[model samples]
Target chain A: MTSPLEQKKIRITGPSVVTANRTWDGAVVYRTAKQGWSTELADSAIVSTSDDARALLAEATADDVGAVGPYIAPVELKDGGKVKPGNLREHIRAKGVTIDLQVPA
Target chain B: MYAYDELDRTLINERVSEFRDQVKRRLSGELTEDEFKILRLQNGVYLQLHAYMFRVAIPYGTLSSKQLRRLAHVARRYDRGYGHFTTRQNIQFNWIKLAELPDALADLAEVGIHAMQTSGNNMRNVTSDQWAGVAPGEIEDPRIWSEIIRQHTTLHPEFSFLPRKFKIAITAAEHDRAAIKIHDIGLRLHKNADGETGFEVLVGGGLGRTPFIAKTIKPFVSGRDILSYIEAILRVYNQYGRRDNIYKARIKILVHELGIEKFAKEVDEEWKAMGDVGLTLDHTAIEEVRSRFSYPAYEKLPHMPDELKQAAHDKLFERWRKNSVSAHKVQGYSIVTLSLKPVGGPPGDASAEQMDAVADLADKYSFGEIRVGHEQNLALPHVAKRDLPVLFKALDRLGLATPNVNLVTDIIACPGLDYCSLANARSIPIAQELTRRFANHDTADLIGRLHINISGCINACGHHHVGHIGILGVEKNGEEFYQITIGGRADENAQLGTLIGPAVPYAEVADVIEDIVEAYLALRDRPEELFVDTVKRLGVEPIRERVYATR
Candidate 1:
């Protein structure tokens, strides 16, 4: 039987940032598509099993649909960031943003 | 002993408050069970079979009198007036309520102790030679490195979510008292060819379902980069370790699957990437930590006390020498191992009063220091040879003078199904029965150096796989039965034991073991042939024949 963690896949998509230090996949400091603004994790993060991602995206569907970003696997956060399995949603929520997610990945 | 500086104290205090909030959140249903489980586990709280079990760290197995007294107080006030010393050199209090855990953490912090990182998939308590500073063969104290590693790994942001639990051990002694070879990371410190102090770093060694003696990744890693080198190894594991299966999550599995050579290559790559800039031990920082663990002042004393010599010539002293005594670094002093494996009792248990008494002895006899061994015994590392009789008398009063150190009766048995939620069967009763059967010390010692370890589950916290005669308690038809394994050991030469034959009814385990010992006596090349060697030379056939021939 697959564990709760194993059965789900997470995909995160957001604006890209290019710097020597911020090039890593799990690096938390990155640029937003909205120009001249940088987003770094200070309070909360987001983790999505495909199911959690799907539910989150469904909730955000009525909002600016295009604002629903791509999905990045939560496990990728181990590269060094405040994002973890337990507090991912809270992290994104704390950043005044909602996550766009997909299911059955 | 690693003295807690302002930072250590501050970190533990902050952890207490953090865990207190977590506990409140859990209790008020603000957190889900899954969320609370990880949170509590990270704080060293476990929901065991009968009740909650809290594992309190004794960093590098060194504890102060004040800390020990606090443990006694916690046991009396919060637990069942007893605590069990664990093989990892930590103390575990059983029967803690989920509500009372926060209070217990608060109590522990009041005396410079906390249970942080004792559980969870993070680096553990960082064990070392219990007699680190005082052991005779030790070139330098291992606790200094252990403390460094401890501080480096505590709530380490990079390592909090490992594939599985990680254990690291260090030994400065040639005899390998800390069992360094069977840990996730083992460090054997030695002076290099250039007269510089360095370490032989071993990686991917562990004991469990798959017991592997660590293979040398670096013949000698310079002492300065120990932290960075370790970080590199963990990075390699974190990126590539198999987390698909819980059983295969340990780095040992990754080492085996990748093969040692390939694993070494990955570690080297990671090491190169994580350079020495932020990770290497600076001389000032190393000195600051090393100063806390500097050698205790030794006043010159006589070469062998007359009283001790007289007692040594007597029967009781001879027995104690065969059992309680260990090699000492000081001429007139000795390292005394206080055996907790008394006949027909729990292997690592001491009552609250007994804990207080051991604390008192540590204060009066051993320069206010106590070392808890991985074998579940306590050590007074600086006992004067002259004080053996008095010490023996005091220990005897506390029922700790069992004279079965490393003998058959001095078994290593886990809390088993009785207290552990993971156990399939009870281990304590089997241990008790074996002790009763081998009640005679002479008989027990005759089967010398017999390390009998029993674990109720495969987690092997009892180190059953390394025992000379290992027994595993398994559940069959909802009843407890024990299966015997032979030739296991956990020292400089560590080997996983092999199963002898079929499982035995719990009631007959002691008799079966006696039969096995009798077989060893009958087929021995000589008395000097230890149990491990004899078993290795002749396999498990003789013991099997003797055990099952009649029944």
Candidate 2:
């Protein structure tokens, strides 16, 4: 019987990617090779190995000037090499808000 | 509204300069993210799922037209052309750049607006009745006391780093529009038999992971002693509140654990010990602060002008008048609620253009005064009775004249998973769907005075716990669902809603609400008995059975 916070502390399984928000404009970004951050999930450097995930996350976390709150999140690999966020929350973040916003006159 | 003095302006300008420096330091890599997060939060900047969100305080929900126009400018210049008015009587911009927040704050500060104390473990904005000054039967304007508390608690050294975030609400009217019972400290202005005014103090009520209706700690605290009495409560809470567990750190938990009697005793002792703290709220002091507020010079006009009578002939304007208009303390004026919950529109969102339009209307019709209510609607606090027809047409042109103030269609929904990082599901779409179902004015007017509040999660930002019809979104098996509750209300008789039954999927929420409405319509004692009163008269079992029977 673990608490929700403690459960979150456990390492996620399967392929994962490091994601954060750009500090300047707060755009959602993902970590890539060479310590790069990209707004596109397709460009994100996905890793399966736990050590590789930890290393990528640590690199993004340390570079606070470029990004903030970097963490490794599980990703789902679809048919034809298509990769997207594994959950609805992450999918919304990668895309945008779910509804058509009211355009004020 | 209270105007800012030179000292207030200087203090905020200095704050803007300091925050600009902090943002610059963070961007230049001189400060860590951990270090800058708290600093940014102090200035009302929060890192959300998609972007940085900024919140600005509209103290006691009162905003002059000038201040409102400035907000419109901020929306267009800094955000995505709109802002969200929250349940706490504050406005939030969902897409602010962290770098540009300082400039935004400065622009707002030019009109004496800031985002301070909107977040973090400090005394948050002091909320009060939106119709405070102009209401018909209020004891005194609660904004005066709310302002006094705001001045006392703004950056007060002792309560700065409290155990948890503290919220205080004050209401001068008997109708309890401020929802005072659901705050850390609730003050209701009361009148004694001798015509002297005082505050009936309540303590330790909140809604988040846990919800509690605040209990009265003191039945009466005289006008001269209200400030001292509040200080005594805060001191007691600061001394004895839980710090060991973050989940159990609110003053509500302390009051619950210590028991109200014991807590009241402790507060009494503290009040007695602090013999003569010179913060006496005497008549002279009260009049001095009251003098700072420039009230509208109202004309002595007759009741319900001919223009309003002529406008009532039109069915649409009649419905809008019946729902969105209320009696004012002034003879010829009315309090007009401009609905933000248009059919299929997002709740509480005002585009920059809409904000500008509202400011224009406020200037033209309402003595340049506007209010943001805790129910996510805007109110023109003082509108001439003769001006109702013109105002309704103006609001209709702006798509804000949805005649559903207390109706079921006037839903309160948080920016759920759509924008909030902590949300478990989406609330806006459900709210939109429900409104779409009840968009017919006749249907909505028939099901009158039913409040539906939706929260994305248990944090209750939308005040689901106190709604007549409460909807709490939950995640189960990686899918979105909602738990519906009944009988909750926000007034003198504030009570948390009881769960009806099991969770329903996203697609079925509107139908569930329909079932609840049908159940109430079928079983209510009379048309005047509200949905909550019906639920109270007959327990939720009948409603639950009817709702699930359709399943």
TM-score for all models, in order of appearance: 0.83, 0.98
| Weakest ten-residue segment in model 2 chain B by summed lDDT | B285-294
Q: Which candidate is the best by TM-score?
A: 2
Residue A98's C-alpha lDDT in candidate 1? Answer: 24
lDDT of 2 at A55: 81
Residue A82 CA displacement from its true place in model 2, Å: 1.9
Q: How accurate is candidate 1 locally (lDDT)?
A: 0.76
Task: Give the number of colliding residue pairs in candidate 1.
Answer: 9
lDDT of 2 by residue, B333-446 (tens): 999999999999999999999999999999999999999999999999989999999899999999889989999988999998898877889999999999999988888878
The prediction achieving the highest lDDT against the true structure is 2
